[model samples]
Target: EAGVAQSPRYKIIEKRQSVAFWCNPISGHATLYWYQQILGQGPKLLIQFQNNGVVDDSQLPKDRFSAERLKGVDSTLKIQPAKLEDSAVYLCASSLATGWAIYFGEGSWLTVV
Candidate 1:
């Protein structure tokens, strides 16, 4: 009945600085995701987690980004040496299954200047 929860509703960092985002998915959900949305664009899947393991991270930019799920409930995403182009909204989403409609959190707005 509840939705996904994300913290630090907004973040501002200079280019090359680091930032982190946290997310807690809805209870009993089996899949979680991290997405990046540039203004006027659809959210791009950064990583996918099924339970406590990674399901897909092919789209993630590993050179500057990392993510992890803890015990299949909580997750965190980090970006080091962030770039100006990293300014965007970071979304956390969850679904009951792989193909289910995902419920998204209010999103973490990042500003890299």
Candidate 2:
């Protein structure tokens, strides 16, 4: 079985530039998640989606960050006017909506230059 896929494993941008990252969850998985992990910190859930609908996004900074899941498959996250403090790893994980291990992708590292 193929694993979760993510792109732009590394990115460098100015403090005010906008950036986006993509994610492709595992096949047949019904739950997808986007997390932000700062250096030396644990992953913080940014958004959680069950199929095509959002289940939780309370931790997401809606004023500057946005995310979406399309057709219950791939997803994308974007940061507008990115801030220096936003430098961190964006991790994508997917689960089967049942009792099982959650698989994570190789996170996208954003560096505010």
Candidate 3:
């Protein structure tokens, strides 16, 4: 089965630094999501997009984090002035439809000192 594609499998930075993660969803998929996973906890949905339009982003920290899915296909997530608590795994996911089986890419690990 085809899955989402993500770049920079891992990243390390100090507090107050900035980083960006990229993602390419499966072809023909219409729903994309970005999730943050902390140690020992389930993934937390940060943003969701449908056909390049944001469907949900209430959990995203707008002050220091931002994401975009252009042309309803590729996406990017950026965090500026990251904090220690922000160290976590960023997951990219996509699916043909909501409520269906969603496939996830290998998470991007972020570590902030």
Best by TM-score: 1
Q: Per-residue lDDT tens digits of candidate 3, residues 33-54?
A: 9999999999999999998999
**By summed lDDT, which 10 consecutive residues of candidate 3 come out lowest?**
1-10
Clashing pairs in 2: none
Clashes of each: 0, 0, 0
- TM-score for every candidate vs. truth? 0.97, 0.96, 0.96
User: What are the runs in model 1 whose C-alpha is more than 4 Å off?
Assistant: none
- Single out the weakest 10-residue window by summed lDDT for candidate 2: 94-103
Per-residue accuracy of model 2 over 42-105 as CA lDDT, tens digit each: 9999999999899999999999999999788999999998999999999999999835678999
What are the clashing pairs of model 3? none
Superposition TM-score, candidate 1 onto the true structure: 0.97
User: Relative to the unseen true structure, what is the C-alpha lDDT of residue 90 in candidate 3, on a scale of 0 to 100?
Assistant: 99
Of models 1 and 2, which has the larger lDDT? 1
Task: State in Å the error of residue 62, model 2.
Answer: 0.2
Q: Residue-wise lDDT of candidate 1 within 1-113, one digit each (tens)?
A: 78899988999999999999999999999999999999999999999999989999999999999999978999999999999999999999999889998999999999999
- Model 2's alpha-carbon lDDT is 0.95
TM match of model 3 to true structure? 0.96
